[model samples]
Target: MKLFGSYTSPFVRHCRIALLEGQAQGTLECEFIETDIVSSGKLSPTKKVPFLTDTLYDEKNKAEEVELTDSASILMYIREQSGLTFFSSANDYNLFCNVNTVLDAAVNLFFLELKDNILPTEGSYLERHSERVLSALQYFNQQEYPTQAPFSDGELRLACFLDWGLFRKRINIDGLDNLQALLKAARSYDIFAQTAPPEGA
Candidate 1:
């Protein structure tokens, strides 16, 4: 199997964390290809990183290639194959989707400022993205988790976004107690530390 993406991308980071966990569990073997936007764009129809490919064998022992075009799909495939479904309930799934939205808003705003040279102004898409990011963070802050709750996929994904947002200087997570706690807890894991983007990258 091959997982193609950049180290700094929150979307790809979450997938890397999961895939690395799978490897530790003896459930998966994959090549994580560190890639860039210009190169990965040519590899996928969507012109994006975090694309994945795997070989599947049937009862007849026939080989076939399976392509997953997005992070969610790739994560799902890994979880299914590994029997490590990190989502335990409807709420977990909802949180996963919500975190995905915040990641989208945060990354878009990051690039719009750093790469696109389009600063956020009142009522612009950039401004709206900022609004979406803060609203989602506040919503996550208002939620509660049980003591020592399992650091599952939803929380893991959220941690990726929080770390990336901070690293990129994209968003302020002030007063978001729940999110702060989760990110802190997730960072304690060896896998989280291992998959983090290269220092000074």
Candidate 2:
């Protein structure tokens, strides 16, 4: 399997963490492909990172190809192929959806400010986005993520997105007490520490 996207992307990071947590090395080898939106133009279709390609033997006993665009799909593919329990129950799935919703909104706000160069100078709309960002952060902060055991996909994805937001200085999440605690707890994980986005991003 080849994973295409930059390390700075939270979506890509989620896929990477899922791969590692699932222990699907032999069946799914990850190859990180760094791409620039302006130059590569590959991210235009989905306008997102962390697309995946899987190679496997087909019924004809020949190597077949499969392509997955969304991070959710890619994560599921890895879990099913590896037979790992990344999302074990209804609660787990619900939490995963919640975290992903925040991630989506956060990323949209980020692009609205940075990519499209539409940073709100002054207006009620600016306040709306800001509120959304904080609400998402606060929601994550309230969750009780298990610190002693390996993190679930939901936790891993949320942590990566929060850290990226901080690294890019996209939003001021400092005032959110719960988010700060979640970030601190997530830092204790070796995977997060090692896979942090490149500095000065």
lDDT value, candidate 1, whole model: 0.83
- For model 1, the stretches where C-alpha displacement exceeds 4 angstroms are 146-149
Q: State the TM-score for model 1.
A: 0.93
TM-score of each: 0.93, 0.84
lDDT of 2: 0.73
Error of 1 at 56 (Å): 0.9
lDDT tens digits, residues 163-198, model 1? 898888887877878877777777777888887878
> Which lDDT value does model 1 have at 83?
74
For model 2, name the residue pairs that clash: none
Q: Any runs in candidate 2 off by more than 4 Å, and if so which? A: 24-27, 120-127, 173-177
Candidate 2 lDDT by residue in tens digits, 71-165: 88888988777777658777778767876776676676777877677764455766576677777777666756665437777777777888888
Using lDDT as the measure, which candidate wins?
Answer: 1
lDDT against the true structure, per candidate, is 0.83, 0.73
Error of 1 at 138 (Å): 0.7
In candidate 1 the C-alpha lDDT for residue 132 amounts to 88
